[model samples]
Target: MKKQLGDSNILRNWIKGFEYCEIGFNKPPNSLVYLACTSTGRVSNLRIQNLDFYAPFPNAICSLTELNSLEIYNWTGLHGQIPSCISKLVNLRSLVITKTSISGSLPSFSKNTNLIGITLSNNHLSGTIPPSLSTLPNLHLLDLSSNYLCGEIPKGGNMGQFNAANFANNTCLCGNPLPTCFNSAHTSAPAPAPVSTTMFDSAPVPAPVSITIFESTPAPEMAPDSNSEFLSPRDLDTEILLLQMKKQLGDPGFLGNWVIDAICGFTELEYLEIYHLPGLHGLIPSCISKLVNLQILLITNTSLSGSVPGFSNNTNLNVIFLRNNHLNGTIPPSLSTLPPNLSSLDLSSNYLCGEIPQGGNMWKFNAANFANNACLCGNPLPPCFNLAPAPSP
Candidate 1:
């Protein structure tokens, strides 16, 4: 066939034989761009970057039976939903569409088995992440960052690492991996069984090596009140093994103005996470520091207010969650005194201020946890470099 055609026409046919194509514009196109013959072309890869074109020839484009990779980036003038025909590209692997105004949930790729990399960032797309996308085995690098997406990040399959920053900017995402919704009743789903760690040293250690610990001793053997359950010895021991306990508190008859003598009793409590106790309010009593074994404390979504108590005595306390309340005054620098093992401490959507505590676990969190609190300052805060150093020494 090449012998029958002129050299010039043959060259044009030869250029079209490649399995890959990239098209872009340095300036506005003077005429419509059409590659009708390229439809039957063998191109397995197509990349269109920084180009100005609206609604490219659709149904025929997806007909590229051997197409493998497709990328469309930084073409702001191109507006509309991604062509639904994209799912027909049976051999497509990597699909990237960034900095475009494509507004839609990612179309399902049920038949596109070879797909691996998918990114649709910086778009106006809205709606939940399709649960179907989680089923892809070879797919990796799913970046939906900087979109107007909402709803919980669906938990399933091998979704690669996700974080608040990746799901930030979007006001409606929540649950584990991301922080729980600000004003919701979703219970924390228990975490998966942890991977076991091993100690490598074989040498015998000294006799008094380290102190062992239990979560809590059983409550004094009181007869079962009509409101409580009678725990058998085994059940009681199991209760003692829980590092964190969440007990529902019902209101005891006490009207508003009476001097509420004390907060609820928790003698052996280690990590107390109190939620939805509507009757509990007023000052967080200073006596809470009595629970020496407490390592984490979260008092969220309540009406409790007043100054955060000084918990300087609880040296072992690592994490503290006091979000979505009306608390006031500066966050206690005493928080910085917690043991170095502290990882996450959320104080978001509150009314606290003053520079963040220095030289401790506070460095692990980002500033959004301090959002809605206008006066807070320091590293996590934006314009953070403008913050002054902690008072010298």
Candidate 2:
């Protein structure tokens, strides 16, 4: 029994080989000293920082099952995968390994439900973030940024609390708080063909075209041979939508570089996302509903206000994220009628109010989907109440 209390000696032996790491007893004022044990003599916390060492992550440390927090910071020479055995530390409440040369996939922490924070930034970790991590109910702070991770971020549990910056610089991380992921079928599309006089000379002219140039760009001088047959009906619709969007959004300067013709050329666009643009303000133009082929619509972290636009015409829309905005007014009841393929929806962190439209695909979402609104009420949320009529007055 006396040998079991000697866990501190075991910890010392594990890190003794690392150059410049000062092994110490309990918490001290010095930053180099990195050990702290519980009253029972169990090693409860280990913080190793700024140590100059070239070694694979020490797997021996995972033996300390009593550890409550494990932090390894700025060890640029530390490499290899985070040891999977570390998950055996069921008491671990925080696991932070940042600014390291660690490579390989993130380990599963499904058993570590006590975890409150995880910061694995600035590493070479690859592959998708495991869906099991999102099931950690107490996990509120997470930073997996600056890694080679990809695929849709799991949306269950507390993931909605995090924003894009937490997952920034990952190769292709998507879903809520980031852009929607594109399926292989919708990966790439051809750019719109440039306008030419000979385009209509060979094909039958479909319709008369009208063009509106924004003040940001100088209007092109009409050539002597230029005619009204320059654009097709599809092109005209896209141009009109862009114009409506520009006018409604106050013509923010960030959009100055968007080539109108090139954007209009994506006649088969399946996904449309506008994210993290604080300068983007005003109501979502209702004209956006005209995009019948759009399967995902995400416009978040902007200053856009006004009611949620009706998407009755967008039957193909499978995902809709309009969170973290200034939007207000009741969720349009028409949304309740969207097809069953409308699987994902989030309107949280906005100024929205009134009963959430119930029925159809809306039943699939829970309180998290409509959370942080001004005064939303209904099933999934608390039931709405009726006001009593005034008495004799």
Identify the leading candidate in terms of TM-score: 2
Candidate 2 pairs with clashing backbones: none
lDDT tens digits by residue: candidate 2, 1-393: 112223333235444344322234322322232555565766666666554546677787788777766767666767777878878877776677777888777778888776656778887777777889889865645888887777788887867667789888876678877987777221211211100000000101122122222223343453443554687887567767676655555565644432232333344665566656676666787766766766556777888898888899988665687999998888899899986446457899997777888877565466878999888889779988872222211
Error of 1 at 232 (Å): 50
- By summed lDDT, the worst window of 10 consecutive residues in model 2 runs over 194-203
Tell me the alpha-carbon RMSD of every candidate.
18.5, 20.9
Candidate 2 Cα errors over 4 Å, as ranges: 1-33, 184-393
TM-score, per-candidate, Cα-based: 0.38, 0.43
Give the 10-residue window scoring lowest on summed lDDT in candidate 1. Answer: 193-202
Query: 1-393, model 1: which lDDT tens digit per residue?
Result: 112222222124335454223232223332211111134556544444444544422345566666555555565544555556877876665566666656655567767665645667776666666667767654533666776666667676535334345455543657556776566432322211101000010111122111111122222344435643776865455444332222222222222111112222444554555544444567677888886655556676677777777788766554476787777777788877775434346788767766777765464455656777646787767444454433211
Error of 1 at 327 (Å): 46
Candidate 2 vs. true structure, TM-score: 0.43
* lDDT (Cα atoms) of all candidates against the true structure: 0.52, 0.64
lDDT at residue 321 of model 1 (Cα atoms): 67
